[model samples]
Target: MCRPTAPRRGYDYRALIMKLSYQLVEQSWPLAKEFRISRGAKTQANVLLLALSDGEHVAWGESVPYARYGETLTSVSQQIERIMPLLSSQTSGEQLNQMMPAGAARNLVDCALWDLRAKKANASVATLLGLTPASTVITAQTLSIDTKERMAAEARTIGNAQLIKIKLDEHDIIEKMEQIHLAAPQSQFIIDANEAWSFETLIQVLPALAKLNVALIEQPLPSNNDTDLATLSSPIPICADESCHVSADLAKLKGKYQAINIKLDKAGGLTEAVKLMQAATEQGFIIMTGCMVGTSLAMAPAYLLSGASSFVDLDGPLLIAKDRDNGFTFADGQMQPHSSAFWGGENNQTNVELARLFTS
Candidate 1:
């Protein structure tokens, strides 16, 4: 007979990304930020910027508006409203998750804690996380889903981008892929299906993607319907985006996906995200760290995780029409974390130029 296990010491290790009041900011894009095959009608995606201030130190984070995840400007705000009382009582990031279920609110608060901690220590977020600061991490410039002609034109315009992430659905996939590949043959390509492809379509799409030298395909099937993935033979490794959130989502994805797209919002914060990266790597899954649409403050923590990631898509800040002051630098599809933007750094001519070129 097995002996009874002793009671665990210390705090229970599950509840994290909790305790933080969120402020939902509705900002407008001068023009509609279009993507290939959008599911919503919003020209502007509502950004929920979280602020976690513990009297002296303050931190900020952002969450993109995703309707597919059952998120909206109103819904996210309502969720935050319900958890407002619970957030103010918590002290550390480790005990935040249990306060509220995993979603964007926890993501923002979790990220804010990392920022607040980094600021209070007077260290970069990377240093705080035990990772070295990186000069640059290659990012994927997105080409909005559209007709071949329109897409080719957009591809030509983003001449500085090293890699182009083309958003796709099941329709005219080869036509769109070939158009971009033909137009930007030298530019590397990655495809994100957003869980829109069926197994049959994936079989049809993967071969063409490989032929075009497409680097990777993201979340081809819906997260709940990944059972068929392991059995099928494919030309390219499929990464889990919607399927994999925090490290806890890893074990179930073992045979189903070759890689995981780690997003701070999905991981609930950078604290768990670091652990998520370690767990994914230990399990032999390649990491691709990404972000949803938000400001530079939101992208900062995700930048810290890039060193170990196989692919980096922290280009959410790049997609916005405007960003807050002292945001991180992103040029030619690469993201560089700032040393002390939150502390100092006035907007200047170069910053204006950077903003105009991308934001326009």
Candidate 2:
């Protein structure tokens, strides 16, 4: 079975004895346009940033408090605050994973610890994880749910994207897919129903979607109704988003889903995400690395899973009105690797300034 490789040998753990300090900052980034999914719509991305320091080098991580998962900014902050007293410079990511349950609160802390360790070791997180950095990855540009005409217009506007992810609801499933396919015939499509469709609706739309050459269908039924999928004989691959989280969920999803979407927040951070990837791969499931709407800080760590994923959807920054100074760069649906100083690399003057800006 595939597993997360151990950290490189000869790392001096004793040198990290300095007392640890932490801060949680809440911020909101406006969206370029309304981002709508099957469940609802939002105009801004509300995120909590975590900063971990040991009196010298500083590292950062971010997570979006999703109400869909019973998390609000206040609750997430309280979660981190409750655990602050128990944390120390020596606390490892694996230990943090055990101390907290899987959710956005644990996601920030777990990711920040990884960044902190990488900074202390003067190496990138990928280097510490024994992963080769990817030069660039083709990310799926998303088109929010809208009228068929407008959705088609948006699809035409992003004609250059190699992959397009469409957010859909129960209404007009066939019409919308037909319009979008006509508009951007060259681009492969991923239809995300976000748990809006009923089993009957899904049964009705399967053949039409398959005809459109849809690459994947994501979470067409509510997570509670995952058993219904075991009855399906879908032509296109079906990926589990809300239905799957950590590696443990894979067994339950075995006959239901052919693919799984790994989001850092849902998986509790990259630490568990890597393990989920390994487990899902071993079980013969295709992997798609996904993300919540946030910023480059959120996407940077998730990017590590790109090389292992067949479909990459780390396009959070692209939907926002503006991103941080050193966000990931996207061109023609391709995302380039972030600068080392961004998050998971050796500490630099820029990182120190970034921490100051967020903590000040």
Candidate 3:
């Protein structure tokens, strides 16, 4: 799960950082299967990848621009391009956090900075962040909305995984879930309604959700109308997805949600994600690390956040066709983080002379 820092290898330590430059790529990778939610269905993950390089030392960060947040690949890409001139060796994560709002654009820049810095320092990002390396992560595989037979069939295929999240809506209520539960009898379930349920559906589903041993319910009501959650009681814990974002959300989500799902894309990046997780814990909210559908580049950074969370849903790579080199490995429901080669792994380096040439 870990490796020693690789030597500079024919590179001058002082020359690793020549000057800073960045670019963004809009990438679309097809999902392994149809992924449906209360919002809709999608067959591909359209993502934006930001590459910040001081020439040879390239650092990458990925973000999935969510339409729910008024962001698309184009908008986020433009945001990064707009902010590029404002960044340099002088810029800091704190400064970037302020320059951009907490969303996809800022997320890309923040993580790219982390990776670049780690590469320059010739160390792991975990060491830079004052965190220990993690052995393995247990990610929550998703069961998208489907018919009873379809869901049950899929559940059985996943086998007796430790955790599986069910995407539910106001339709079919108990029937599909009951079938799924029967199919994956050994799995723990989390219900993600995606703001589809009403006050009536909320009340109606709680008992069956409890009976099915659903561990949590995620965003059953819309963010704006979730005030009622403060008063309602349910057997299973209620988590906030759409309702929670940065640390600022901790104040409002305190009484309304028992858990908060933190996506690095949504919370900005690992810089803000760590802060949000700390703040969420301080405010008595159990944390769940989640993701949008993307490749291993997205999941690799998110794997850092999973170390401290109660529930982890960084299964984005598992839903895709393939991944970047040495991507995370998911087997027996456990996920091992990617090697340093993929992102900010130990001994990551490039030709300082080539980087110097680019800077020149």
Candidate 4:
């Protein structure tokens, strides 16, 4: 029930009453390689980009419609269109939360609203939220599910990485872990099963994974079957990805997962993401900020959470073949802060022009 705060001194309240215009654009960015996980593989990142304008400042937001969450581009678009008439310059984040259910559709609109507010206020989102912007953050470089040899080779290629996340299924669990560990012994590992493991498989692989310096295990068991985790003790920390979304889900995850993965797409956007992060920290859950396979545009807002996260997995741009102009820069596994003009900052003529191109 958090409401918008009172306007600051010199703020123009009239802007809040202005009529808002919006446009939804579909974009497809090719992946550098096939990204494989327990569910399937994808060669490209299909996203829905949302643009919001108040006849002056323009703001942008992007979200990936994941089939795993029963979200498709058409369905997400319809959800946004249905809610469009309710949105105005006066809409508050809390109001939006009540207006739409948390998912990819809400994520796209929520982020666009944040960007719009920041622009109208002539401030950065970080500054408005009272957070110090990070210059660079250590991000996990992910190795997709593949043959043992190929996965090991990929690990070796990024041997200097501080954190490496490996996607795995229920098959050849120990063998793949051993091979990848041998190839990158210096690097810590995060095993992301994407809910492909059973209680028996997870128990069997725990010892081997612990010995291999695996720092964490992500969603090893299906969301519905994860109650089994509370019954057994695990060596490495367990993180909930698919099982946990909004702050309301945290109560059930207690004693089951040591951590939770906060993806803007999953949390619905930065607005809810901030609430979830604060609640998760207060409950002593390890924070891991992650992302769906997306371009830098999607990562920009999520990057704001890196300072508070113990594990950062915002390497979606690294997996993509190309990124938007002025995208975030990644070097030796660290993602440098993006330009203010790129996203989540004061009004920029460049972004307004870009919005015009997409919306026109």
lDDT of 4 by residue, 93-189 (tens): 8899999999999999988888888888888888877765467989999999999999999999999999999999999999999999999999999
Candidate lDDT (C-alpha), each = 0.69, 0.87, 0.81, 0.87
lDDT of 1 by residue, 1-360 (tens): 112132234322122334433333434332236534434323444566555544444455666556667777556656665655566524466777776666777776666666666656666667656785357888888876788888988888886678888888788999988888878888888798888899888987777789886888899888889899989777788899999888889889988888899887777777778889999999999888887766666677777777898788877666666666666777777776664645212211223322232224
**Can you give the TM-score per candidate against the true fold?**
0.83, 0.93, 0.91, 0.93
lDDT of 2 by residue, 1-360 (tens): 112123224422123234776666678888999999988999988888877778777878999988889999878878887777788767877898899999999899888888888888888888878765467999999999999999999999999899999999999999999999999999999999999999999888888898886999999999997798898899999999999989999989999999999999999988899999989999999999999999999999999988888999999999999888677999999998878898897555456546674456
- Alpha carbon lDDT at 55, candidate 3: 59
Error of 4 at 120 (Å): 0.5
lDDT of 3 by residue, 1-360 (tens): 111133224423223223776545566787788999999999888887666777557777888899999998667867876778677755778888889999999988888788888888888888888765358977889999988899889999996698999998889979988999999988999889999999888988788778886998999999999988888977888999999998988889877789999998899988888888888888788889899988788877778877678999988888887665578898968998776667866677643422332454
TM-score between model 1 and native: 0.83
Q: Which regions of candidate 2 deviate over 4 angstroms?
A: 1-18, 347-349
**Residue pairs with clashing backbones, model 3:** 6-347, 107-268, 340-345
Q: Give the higher-lDDT candidate: 2 or 3.
A: 2
Worst 10 residues of 4 by lDDT: 1-10
